[model samples]
Target: MRQAEKRAIERVASKRRNKNSSSSNDEFEAEHICIRTCGRELKCGKHRCQQMCHRGPCPSCLEAIFEEISCNCGRTVLQPPQPCGTRAPECRFDCTRPRPCGHPQVAHNCHPDDLACPKCPFLVEKGCICGKKTLKNQPCWFEEPRCGLVCGKKLKCGTHSCNKLCHRPGACEDEGISGSHCQQLCGKTRSCGHLDTERCHAPYPCKEDKPCQAKTFVTCECQHRKQEVKCSATKIEPSPQRPLLKCDDECLRLQRNARLASALNIDPQTHTNDHVPYSDTTLKLYRENPQWAHIYEREFRVFAEDRAEKRLRFKPMKAHQRAFIHSLAEDFGLDSESSDPEPHRHVCLFKTPRFVSSPMKTLAQCAKICASQDSSTQQATIANDATAIPYNALLLTNPQFGLTVEELDAALRKEYAAHPTVKFHTSFLPSDEVVLKGSGTWTSQTLEASLTALKSTLQHTVRRLKLAENVFLCSVDDSLNVLRREGGQAQREGGWSAVVGRSTGRIRMPRDR
Candidate 1:
C-alpha cells in the first residue's frame, strides 16, 4: 500500500512536470517509479480497464463506460455515456411501439417494455356525460366529456335528473355508480311511504344499516298492540297487499304463537303467556393507544381546518404512526408525503392546489446556523431535512434540431398550460447550444413530474413538426460548477454566454392540425 501511494504521488508529479515542459522549450523526463493507467481491454471488448497501473493481468473493466444504447421503442438512441450494465437511456422520441388502445400515440416518456403506457393524450369526439349529445375535442382518457349542460336523465327516483356534470349515461358504470353521480338529496318515498332525504344514488332507497329515521305510529294486524317507532321499523311494503306491520316484541311473539297454535289446534292468545323477549347491545373496541390516537386526530383536525396553515409536518415517528397520519390526512382531503430516510422520516400534509413550498434554508445554510450547537443535534436536523431545497435547477438543450431555448419554453407553456407555476428562461451556452433553465415556485409540482412532462412535450412536438431534435434534462448547477472549475471557460475560450429569453413577443405556433 505504501509503495502504491508513493508511485501514485510520483505519477501525478511526473504528469505535472510533463505538461509544463511540453508548453515550454524543455524536454520532458519520465519518473523512474511513476504509476500509470491499466489500459487493457476488458472482457466486454467495448471498454478498456481504467484501474491504476498494477502487476500481472488487469482485472475486469470496473469502469462505467457511457455509450449509445437504443431506447425502449428502438426508434432512437441517447448517448449520454453510461456504464455497460446500466439501464438503456430513456428515449425522448415518439414510441413506435403499437398501442392496443388504437390511439395514434401515447403521451409519456419512452420506458421499458414491462411498464404500462400512460393514458392517451389525443382528443376525440365522444358523447356527453348525459348521453344526450355529442361533444368534440375531449381527451381520450376521459370516459365521457362534460357537455357543459345539465344531466337531465332521470335518476333511480324516477323523478329528478342526476343533475351532475353532463356525462355519458354509462359513465357511472366505468367510474362506479356513486362515483359519477351528484350529491343532491334522494327525495323518493321510502319503503315506509315516508320521504327520504338521503343523497341520490342508483342503489335501492334504503339498506339494512341505513334505515329511515323518521318517526311513525304502527299497530299489529291483530289490532292487539300499538307503538311509535322509526318508519323503517314498520317495514311497510310498497304494495298494500303485504302483511301488516308488527309493532312490538309482544306483537311478534303473539303472531308466532298464533301460527304455531293453528298448526297445533291451540288458541294463540292462550299459548303466548309463557314466553320472554330478548334484547341485545353492541360494544366497540378501541385501538391500543387510545390517547395517542385521539391526539393525532385532534391535531389533524386543527391542521385541516386552519385556512392559513396550508401544510402540516409531523415529527419523526414510527412506521405505524406515519401510516396512521397518512390515512388521517387523506380523510381530510389533504396530500401527504414522507421525506428523509427511515428512522428519522416523517409525514407532511398539504392542502389545496397541492403545492410543495420551497425550503427555508439549505443544508449548508442550516449548518452555518447551527455552528454553535451540538454536533448530534445538527446532524439529526440535517438528516431529517435531506430533501430540503433539493435540485430545483434544470437545463434543456436540443442541438441537432437547431432548437432554441426560447422555442422550448414556448412549446412547454403551450402544451401544458395547466402548470403555470414553472417559468423558463433561456441562455446561450459556451458550446453554442441554446439552453433553457427552468425553475418553479413553491406551488409547482414535483421535479419528477416536471422532467417527464418536459421530455414528453418536446418529443411529441418535434415528431409532429417532423423536426429531428433530441432533448434531455441537464442540471444548471452542474454547468455552473464546470464553469467555475474551468475559471469561466466561456471567457477563457473566447466563447460568450448571454441571457436570451424575455417576456415580450413570445412566438406561438399554429395548433396541431
Candidate 2:
C-alpha cells in the first residue's frame, strides 16, 4: 500500500510537469517507455488496454491493469474495485468472475450468486434487489435481502377493527390501502401512484416493475389521492356552464317562502338563517319578498334589542348555500339607502361572466421547472402524463380558475404559479361598439403597434387578477373577413370581409372580395 501510494504521487507530479511544460523552443523529449500506457491483460494478449494506449492511466484508478466486474449471469462488466462512500453497505457493481483472486475458492461460490454482498448492494435471496416490487419512481432502499425499513414497524391494518388486523382506507394515520401501495408493508418497500422526484410527476405515467430495485425510483406526491400540478394546468378557453350544487335536506325545510327564497336564493322548503340581520337591509328584504308580507308587518318589522331573540329569528341557508347568496345580495340591495353599503356591495365578483383563459402567460411552467433542475434523472413513470403547468404566478394565489380559499394555498410553491390575466366568463360580454376595419395590407411592425393599443384598454382592472387570457378565445364570426391582427398571417381577406380582427383596425367590417 505504501509503495502504491508513493508511485501514485510520483505519477501525478510527473503528469502535472508535462501539462505545465509547453516550451516550443526546447528540444523534443523522447517518449518514455515505462510511463506509456500498460493496458488491461485480456485474453487477446498481454497487451495494454486500448483506452490506456491512447490516454494515460485512468483517472478512476492508480493501477495500469484494472480488474473487470460483472453480474452473476454470464455477461462481463467493468466496475470500480471499491466504491467511494461513507455509508455502510455502499452500492457497487457485481463482480462476476469465476476465478478472480489468487484464493482457492471461486469468486461465485464465496460470494454466491443469489445474495448481494456489502460491496455490491443490489443482491437479494431470490432475485435482483432492483427487481423487487416498489413504488413507481421511488428510490431503492433494500438493506440486505429482506432486512429493510419495513421490518421494524409492526404492521397495523387500517381496514379492519384494531383487534382484527387488516389494512383499510383511513384505518390508521400511516396505513395505506393494500392495492394502493401494491400491498407492500411500509418501509419494506416503496409504493406506487406517486410521481418520481426526478420527473414531472403530476400525472403518474409508469407502473411497478417487480424486477426493478426499490428506492431506485422516487416517491410521488399524488399517492393514494393523486395530486394535480397546482399551478400548471390551465384551460384558458372552453365552453361555459355551471356545475350542479346540492344542499342538505334539513336546512331546506325551515326557510320555505319562494319570494323570500328567491331574493336570498334559498328554497322555500329549506334554509335556516345562520347570522342575524344586524343591518336594516335584512329587515326590508325580509318584507319585500311578497310571501313575507304578514311577517314583515307583524313580527320582523319591529326592532328588538334582545340579542338572543334576534339570533334565533331569521332563517339559515343550507350548507352548500353558494346559490343561496342571491337572497343575501337582494337583502343588502333592498336597504341600500337606509344604511351604508359595504365597499364590495356592487362589484359582481361571483357568478356572472363565463371565464376563459388568457392567451398570454406570465412565465412558462416548463421553463421554470427546467431552470431549477438540480437532478437530470429521467423519471420514466411521469414522462408521459405530465400536466401542462401554465406557470402563472397570480393564478397560484388568486381564485382565477373558480378556486376557493382551501385548494390554492396547499399546492406546491416551486412547482407552479398562477398566470396574470383578465378572465371573461359566459356572463361576460365584449364591448357593443365595434371598431372599424382597416386595409388588409399592413407590415408586422404596423400590426404590432395596432395590437399594443388594443391591449392597453383591454387589460384587467386589477393587476393581481388571477384570470387567464379570455381575449384569445374571442374569435370573429366566420364568413365575415374580420381584421385579425395575427402576426405574419395575411389579414384574412376571403369571404364577406365584414368581420375585422384587431390587426385590421381593431374593428369588424366588410370589404369586397
Candidate 3:
C-alpha cells in the first residue's frame, strides 16, 4: 500500500512538471516573438496570426489587453510608470490637462491625453471642430460650433473665424452669455408727452414718414450754370450763326490757291502776263503753278525753255542775209557743186550792211546775224574794208560736210602754193572756221583771186558738195554810209572828233572827169 502511494505521487509530480514546462515555453515564445510590423518573427511558431508585426503587440492581443485594463472613461491604459526615486517616471499617459480644467487624476496605464477618447468630456480634443489635429488641448468648438463641412462661412463678426471643426457663426456659448444684454438706450418722445425708455432692440414711438424734397435742376448746354427751374429740353437748338462759322468751299479753294501762289513766288491777284518778269515764259509758268512745279522742272521746263530760246533768240536769217549767204554758198560750191548739199553745211564771209565803215561796231552785230542763220551754219564774219573784201574768212568744210581734214588741208595747201607771196596764216577754228589772216596790203583783187582758186580746189577734191549757192560775196555801201553818219554824230557828241576823222577818212569817194 505505501509503494502504491509513492508511485501515484511521482505520477502526479510528472504531470505537474509537464504543465509548468508547457506554460513556460508559451511565455518564452510570446516574449521572443517580434511585435514590430516589419519584424521577421511576426507570429509564434504556431503561425496563428499569419501577418506582419505592426511595430507593437498584435491588434487582437492588444484589444484583449486594452479591455482588461481599460479605464471607465473608455481610454486604453498606457504602460506603468517607473517607481519614485528610482528614476523620474516616464508617465505613459500623455495628459496635457491644465490645472484649470479640473480633470480627474489620470489612472495608471491610461492615455490621459488620448484625444480620440470620446467618453472623457473634460479632456478636450487635440484639434478644432474642423477635424484638424493639434498638440494643445483645444476645445473642438471653442470660438464657435462648426464641423469640417460648415467651416469658413461668413460669421456675425464680419470676419472668418477659425476654420476648425465644431466652429459656427456668432460668438461661442460662453461669450454670448457674458455679454447678452443690449447696451443702447432709446430717447424718443411718446404720444403721451413723456420720454420713452427702452433698449435699442425696442421700437421708437415718435417716428414720422416724410416725402423726398430733393430738388432737380437744368442748365445751359454749356453746363456753366444750374437753376431750380426746369430748363427747356427742346434739343438745345443750334445758334442761327452756326452755319456761318465754317468757311465755304470757294473760300477754302481761294486760300489754297493763295498759299500755292505764295510758295511759288507768284502774286495771286495779278492775272496778267506782266506779273511774270522773266522773259522766259516757261520759267514764269513754273513759278505760277507751284503745285506742278516738280513735274514741270523734271519733264517740261527744260525742254520748253530750250524750244522757246531756239525760236525767239535764234530766228531764221532775213532775206538780205539769205541772199548774202547764198553768194557764200556759191563760192564754197555749196549751191552748184553737188546735186544734194548737206543742209546748213555752208560757211560765209560778208560785210554787215550796218557796220562796213566801223569794224568795231560790227563785232556785236556779227554774232546776231550769224545766229539768225541755219543751226548748222558754223561761223560767219563782217569786214569794214571799202572794197567789201573779206580780211578774215571762215571755211566750214568739216567731216559733217563730207569734207575730211586731209581734203581740206590739201585744198588749202594747193591754194597757198599758187599764191606764195600772199603772207597769210591759216588756223582751224573750234567754231569750224578756217581763219585766213593777211597783211593790210592785200587788196580786194588779190583776195578775190585767192578765193576763186580755193573754191576750184574744194570743188574738185571734196565729194557730193556744192560751192555755188552756199557761197556769197556782197557790198553794202548804202548800209555802211548810214551807219557812218550815225557813228559820226555819236562821236561828235562824245568829243571823239579825231576818231571820227580817222575812220571816215578811210572811205573812198568817187571822182568825176
How do the residues 6-79 of candidate 2 rate in per-residue lDDT, one tens digit apiece?
68758877885676576564556635434444566533333435442444343333234344444344353555
* Weakest lDDT window of 10 consecutive positions for candidate 2: 388-397
* Model 2 alpha-carbon drift over 4 Å, by segment: 1-149, 152-436, 439-480, 483-513
**Each prediction's TM-score against the native?**
0.20, 0.14, 0.15
- The model with the greater TM-score, 1 or 3, is 1
Error of 2 at 457 (Å): 27
Highest lDDT, which number?
1
- Considering TM-score, which of the candidate structures 2 and 3 is the better prediction for this target? 3
Tell me how far the alpha carbon of residue 31 in candidate 3 is from the true structure, in angstroms, after superposition. 99
Relative to the true structure, candidate 1 reaches a TM of 0.20
Best by TM-score: 1
Give the lowest summed-lDDT range of ten residues in model 3.
352-361
Give all candidates' CA lDDT scores. Answer: 0.54, 0.30, 0.35
Q: Candidate 3: lDDT of 492?
A: 17
Ranking by TM-score: 1, 3, 2
